[model samples]
Target chain A: MLIMKNINKIFQTADIQTHALRDFCLQVNEGDFVSVTGPSGSGKTTFLNIAGLLETFSNGEFLLDGEDVGKLNDNGRSRMRNEKIGFIFQGFNLIPDLNLYDNVDVPLRYRGFNAKERKFRIEQNLERVGLASRMKHLPSQLSGGQQQRVAIARALATDPRFLLADEPTGNLDSEMAQSVMSLLEDINQQGTTIIMVTHDAQLAQRAKRTIQVKDGKVSELENISRQHNQAIA
Target chain B: MLETGLILRALARNKIGALLIALQIALTMTIMVNAIFMIQDRQQQMQRKSGLDEKNSFYLTNTVFGQDYNIQAHLQTDLHTIRNTPGVVDAIQINAIPLSSSGWSMALQHEPGEDKDAVGTAIYMVDDHAINSMGLTLVAGANFQPEDVELRKEGQSTWPAKTIITQAFAENLYPDNWQSAVGKTVYISQTQPIQIIGIVAALQAPWNGWNGVERSMLVPFQRESKGSYYFIRTEAGRRDELMPIIEKTLAESDKKRIIRRVTTIEDTRERSYRQHNATNKILTTVVITLTLITGFGIVGLAIFSINRRTKQIGTRRALGATKGQIMRYFMMENFIISTFGIIIGCFGAVALNMWLVNTFNLSPISFQLVAFGVITLFIVGQLAVLYPARKAAMIAPATATRTI
Candidate 1:
């Protein structure tokens, strides 16, 4: 589970102070797929960064899996990130110099997994993403969809309980975007909680829960698919 | 588990920068090791003893430009005046001084014939007081007696019968037993017999660079010539005080002779090996400069590599790599590259040393020196990469999400 209450983030420079996030509040239960949708400059990325423990919030109560994230030091936060949360970037941030298997092995290496354990996890995740056959190939050698799948496999290699994806299909065609969306649904159904930040309304509708962020705060939480199913019943 | 294999694979794909730095380290190691070896070699040569009281001795060129100069009478007068000086320990009229780079040499044959092979040695002409005046220790036999002193005019080829040879020369001439050389006859100047009356511990030749620098002997014949060196020894700490006094005394004695070139043995030794000293200084500078350039080259390459990999480093951070892990990755990368370079440099050093041995007749280098090179370059490489690695580690993980 992940929770944030009145989280705020400010960016300060020599002559300007930009309030990126103000009084943000969000909570997601176990196995939930939450999609956050917002316009540019609505603080969606800042919210996701703080939620993923990639950056610290200015002041707030934030708890991830029952641990106070605001109280953790940088090293402890890194350890929590390695152990509890997985990330998939829009750029398919696979290290270009490493092959697909090696890219997947990166997080697992930081997790202090033995070579045999890491190899098993890497193969399993790459197979889950349908990239096992091309595990030896580089990210540049694959198509956009396949590269996104490899990124998904890398995020899954450490068996983290939570996943944060920032516009995972932003650089892909609509077809590849749908395919990656389906993969995320599958991962969520398998009991891994996921929070996806995107601008596409159609893709946002596919999640079990959707929230709209505006003026650095979540303005709406709508369970659109559950309501439509209930009306059909 | 470390990221060593990952880093190596990455470097294999992008090998140019790392390869160039490695080659620079290799070249530095090769030159540095050999330069240190040559410096140590010269230092050892400079450390050799010249078998004289070098610290308390002085010599001057007593060139007589006067007509009908009673060379023998003046030699006695000059010796009496120098000997009676308050601080003078002893004085002698000699043909040459040790390590001055200018002197006489002759070959002594076991058999007196044109077909016979002979051993070469430097010749120093002095009187019976030669041993005491030059501070030579008679290890095997007695010093020269006064009756054995002889006078030899300039351009005369006649030789003295009694001589004192150094232990090094004694070892060469009588390898069986050097002590047996005393009182034994040997042939010098192609047939004249001269007996080795005593054996001194050590006496270097006039030329310090000569291979036979330790092979020399004192012949008992004060040179009655137009020009000769007045070899004087003073009590400890008085050589400098007495040098000016002696030069003034000899110059003002008759005005018939111009006594010039007053110099101490220490100064002569310095002038004799000035080239060796200068070469050592230059070599030391080259070593230091090359090491610094190689260090800076490593830093430059590492900074470039980190700048190029900024996004990748941020991604790694987002994937949960601690700052320490990132630093270790770069330092380990430098270690691998330095190890590769040291391997190539070992062969390069050996090849260069072989060339020197064959071409310049230098001895082969030591293994310890090559190991020292390997370790020095490794430290330089690691230290050079530290700052850039720290910079890479400080990159925010949020950079991975930014479009750039």
Candidate 2:
């Protein structure tokens, strides 16, 4: 449900110009779990930021659910981001002063949901993430994995159509990472499109499709099932 | 409303900063209320009307410098020359002009040697023309007749038999009704009883700060001595033009006597209230300075809070908060802090006013003044918080969320 054609992103300074992304093209259909793999400074996060409508590209044609993203202003972008896109940062950026329930209630608040609707969505999402019993606990009182789960619940509270995750399990242990990955897989199976960026090859292999980025360009694209079959043949 | 709860929790995390700002606001409110009240009271006091045509009259004060000078003859000649001068309406010799802050006072009783507490009243000695010269409107009875005019020589203590008392002075003597005081005989310091032949509408004395400034009386007497005061009334809009002419005439009439001062009654009134005016100005300056300092204090605290909560702000921005929402959050935070301070300040204001009322006898603070102070603080709080809030709102969501 997303398309990008020949996207270009440039960062300019006083005496130098750097290309963060150039001639990048990608497409993902509805109900797909795609993973982006790249080294540091390879424009992976830039691509994700642009795709999520958080940053603007210099020249591009981007269509999400059949609407041109390049034509929207700041406010329009914010509305689209709030209504149709959810984000999972590597930092698990839950507002520390708020309890878990209020943390999950942030997106719903910006979405202009009434209190009853917000409450129902927050509880349901927290329950889905197995953190409903600790809704009153603060993020500081929870472990990294729990905080990430709360972030996921916050992202889901708006019932976004597309999820953009950047290193969602970067700070967790192997067991916690596996649990988060499995939860993401389950969410994707429920028909919410997810695009995850990861450095781990094993985590990237878990997705239905993987795209490798290098030198501000997409270098490879592979289907896991086809790769598995090719390896057997 | 949910934002308010969030703001409260955030403020709870920075209790010391919030309390300091609140205390500053409270102090500002207290000082502002009291200072404004004192200024208004002083302005009202200054605006009290002196029962005379102050704009069209001037006073010439002279002191006899030579030992062989004939005081009465020179006074009569100077009076005649000034009266005959162009634009001169009327002139009379008196011991002191009204609002000169230098006059005589005496205790009055209904009868000679009476045992009741005597009422204090300001005394003025003037001739038959003094009533019209000073622009005093006689409300009852009549002005002093030519036969009632008595010439008081040096060392004489007894006053004239007929006197004109102000309505305020009459009320003091006969509290039941001032009209009854007319035609009644009142004793001055166990001397000969004098009849209140007339009553004037209103006459403010020189010392207007006294509780009984309006209590004054006029007696028909030609006060000619070493020191004399000549009050000359000019035609409408002619006092300023005739001041120099009066000075030159009086100086040439008697070279032995020195013209101590030549000034208008308005100037004399201004000189009398100089201290009160100075106090009002000082209080106004203080109020302005305190308000400015409090506003700066709020600005400093708001900037500091914005800096400290930058990450939280960024997180909210990324969670789909619009720029307007971010700005409103900071504004709401400031509003809560200011409201708390104002609530505490209201009690402090009342307590301070009560102390002033008890200690200095000032008027108590009114409800309108308290509301005014509250609204002023709210406006100042919003204005002070705006710059930092706008700065916070302009932060880019992409860059802010990249802070990890």
Candidate 3:
């Protein structure tokens, strides 16, 4: 559901130029799960940003749900992002002032859903994430894992075409991370495309495919079992 | 609606800042209300009637020649020359002009037949024509005639023959009926007893701020009288033309003795009005300046406030709010803040106007003042909100995903 070809992002100051992304590429198909792994300064975050329409690429062609994202203005990009993409941030960036239910309902409201429909969708999403009983609780009132679940619930409530998760379990403990990863896998099993960026090799090994980025370029694209068999041979 | 609610919630977070703005609005409004009241007070002072028909009248200080000219001959010559001037309608030679700040007064005790003792009235030695020339209405006896000035005719008494009493004097002693007040006796001092020939309405002196004084009583000029002025009515718009002729007709010696100021009666009225309005004009300017500064201050602060909340605005924008919605959010937020201030300010204004009325003896309340207050507050609100709302509306949703 997402595609990027020869995407480049460069930051220029008066006397300094930094290449954030160069010759970067990414693709995610329907019902497929993909993980991108990199160190701190790699172009993985930049690729995810361009793919999700959060940042513009300097020289690139991005097709999101088959529409040319590079041609969209700020407002048009925002509209497409709201309608077609769900973001799960490493910080679990739920609005602190809102309760869990309203946090999940926010994107739905932007989609012009009425009050009754928004309530129903928010409750169903919260139930799907096993947080139905905590709908009225604040983010600060929940544990790290519960908050990530709320974030996931928020992402799925809008029924976006694809999910873009940037370090979804970066702040969680091992147990919480595994639960979030299992929940993400179940969502993928239910036929939703998820593109997650992480630095954890163990978590990257669980995805259908793992892409390693280094120095603003993709260093390796490996499948899970084939790489293991090749290592055994 | 949701956007506006969001703005209000943000404003509520900075309660102290909002309160400061409210206080500024209230204080400025108080100053505005007082300034308006002071202007109205000045207007009332300007329009208040001075008891004479100051229009068409001019004063000339004409002096008789010779140390021993004899008041009777001097008066006859001056009156005859002045009456024949081209634009001359009527003239009076008097010791004091009505409504002028300068005047002469005498304390009188009631004689055997009079009702009161020790009543003071302004004394003016006027000829027969001074009454009608000054446009004074007679409520009783006939005005003194030229024939009564027997010193110029035959052998008339020159000491004191008759006098006109002002209505205030009549009201003081008689309490009713100027007729009974007339035909009574009054003495300028212990020596002179003048019969009352006419009772005229009270005259307002032009320079006085208010009415209700015994203006002037008329009498024929006596030989002992000296240092008197003449009031002449030259047709409206013709005073300038009459000045040179009047100068030519008076004795050359008298011309040099014309020490008084002369101008149109309209100018005199405006002079009186100008004095009363000086404070009001100054107050108005100050109030207007302060209100404008406060309004711009509000605009500047609102811009700063919206800039600080850009992330919140971007989030709202990302939630499908239109530009118009964001604009209305800021505008409505400011309107609520201004409204609260205006309501409090109205009370403050009332208290201030009342204090001015009670302490300073300023002008009374006028009904139109409320409309001015409301309009000023609304204007402040709109001007303060316009640029801020526009800026808020222009904030892009991309800002939400970017590092705050």
Candidate 4:
């Protein structure tokens, strides 16, 4: 589970102070699919960054799996990120020079997995994403949708309990975006909590809950999947 | 360990930059090792002891430019006055000063035939006071007696029968046992049988660049010539004060001869090796400049590589690579590149050394020095890349999410 309370992120420059996130309270439980939606410069990416521990906030209370994140040192944060969290960026963020196999091996190497274990996970994840045959190909050799699948395979290779994806399908067409959304749904069904940031309304509805960010603050939107489950119970 | 193979694969794809730097390192090692070797060779040559009381001894030339003067009687008078003066230890009339770059050399053989191979040695013409005046240690035999001294006229072809040889020349003549050379008779001038009556521990020849610089021989000779050198050894702490006094006394005692070239052995040694010292300085400058250029080359290449891979580094950081791991990545990359350079450099250094050995007739380079080169270049390469690696480590992981 991931929880945030009154998280504040202020970017200070020589001449300007930009508040990226303010009072950003959030809670993501196990096996929950949450999508964050906002316009450009609305703190959507900042929330994802703070949640992923890619950047520190100015003042905040962040708890990941019941451990206080603010108290963790840099190495502690990196260990938590390696053992429990994974990330997928909109641009695929695949190392251009590395082939699919080596690209997927990056995090597993950092995770301290043995050669045999890393190979098994790399093969299994590539197979799950339906790109097992193209494991030796570089990212440029693949189409737009294929690269995102490879990215998703890399994210899942470490068996992370929580996955943070920033616009996972933003660079894809409608058909490719829908396919990646279906892949994410399948991952969430396997007991992985996911928080994805996007601007697509259709993709937002597919999640169990949705939040909208405006001017460095967050507000809950309608929760169709939660409401449907409550009605059935 | 796992990063090695991955970094190698990545470098294989971008081989140009790394290959260029490797070649630079190879060339640097080649010139650097050989230059140091040359400098060491010259330094060894310059450090040889000339077997003189160099600090307490000085010599001056007495040129007879007038007629109707008894040169032999005045020579004795001058020696008597200089030796009886205050603070004077002993004095002699020497044919040449060691390490002065001008002297006489004669070849000696066991038999009286020119067909046999002869060992060459520098010849010093001095009398019984020679051992004390030059501060030479009699390692094996005795010094020349006063009765053994002889008067040698100008253009004399014959040599004195008794002579004292340095241990090095004794070894050359009697390679089996140098102490046996004390009573051995060696034929000089191909036929003149000269007995080695004594053996000094060491006495360098006048010509420092000669291969057999440590081989010298002293003969008992009081020369009767138009020009000669008066070599004097003063008491401790008195040479500097006595240098001018002795020159003045010798000048005033003889109106027919002019006292000139009043020089200390120390000054002669410095003047003798000035060229070696200059060459060593030049080679040192070259080594320093080459090393610095190679270091800057490494820094430039690492910085360019880090700038190109900023986003990749950020993505790796986001994927759970710690800052230390990020720094190690670049450092390991440089290590791999440096390993390649060092391999080529080893071969390049040896090849260059072989050429130098063949061309310059120097000894083959030492393995320890080559190993030293390897360690030094490796350290240089790593230190050169440190700042750029740290800069790459400082890259924020949020950069992976940026569109621009």
Best by DockQ: 1
On a 0 to 100 scale, what is the lDDT of residue B227 in model 1?
Answer: 89
What value does DockQ give for candidate 1? 0.80
After superposing candidate 4, which stretches have Cα over 4 Å from the reference? A226-233
Which runs in model 1 stand beyond 4 Å of their true positions? Answer: A225-233
List, in order, the clash count of every candidate structure: 0, 0, 3, 0
User: Interface Cα RMSD per model, in Å?
Assistant: 0.8, 2.2, 3.9, 1.2
Ten residues in a row with the worst lDDT in model 2 chain A?
Answer: A223-232
Give me the overall lDDT of model 4: 0.91
**Over the stretch A26-74, how does candidate 1's per-residue lDDT look in tens digits?**
8899998999999999999999899888899999899999999999988
Give the 10-residue window scoring lowest on summed lDDT in candidate 4 chain B: B1-10
lDDT of 3 by residue, B1-404 (tens): 34344345446657777777877888887778778877776686566554455777777665543465566666667777788777788877766665555676655555632444666667666677876666678888888877764332333333466788777777776776656877887666555677888888766543455433554566665333545677788767777788666766674535434434554456666665666667777887898888888788788878887887777566555444556767876778778788878888888888888898899876655657866876887787788789878988888654554544
Clashing pairs in 2: none
lDDT of 2 by residue, A1-233 (tens): 89999999999999999999999999988988899999999999899889888889999899999999999987788888889888898888888878899888887878888889989999999999999999999899999999999999998889889988989989899999999999999999899999999988888888888999998899998866524745777
Please give the lDDT score at residue B274 for candidate 1: 98
**Chain B TM-score, one value per candidate, order as shown:** 0.97, 0.93, 0.78, 0.97
lDDT of 2 at A224: 65
- Candidate 2 local lDDT, residue B229: 88
Where does the lowest 10-residue lDDT sum fall in candidate 2 chain B?
B395-404
TM-score of each predicted structure versus truth? 0.97, 0.93, 0.70, 0.95
Model 3 misplaced regions, further than 4 Å: A3-233, B47-76, B88-90, B93-229, B240-258, B319-322, B360-367
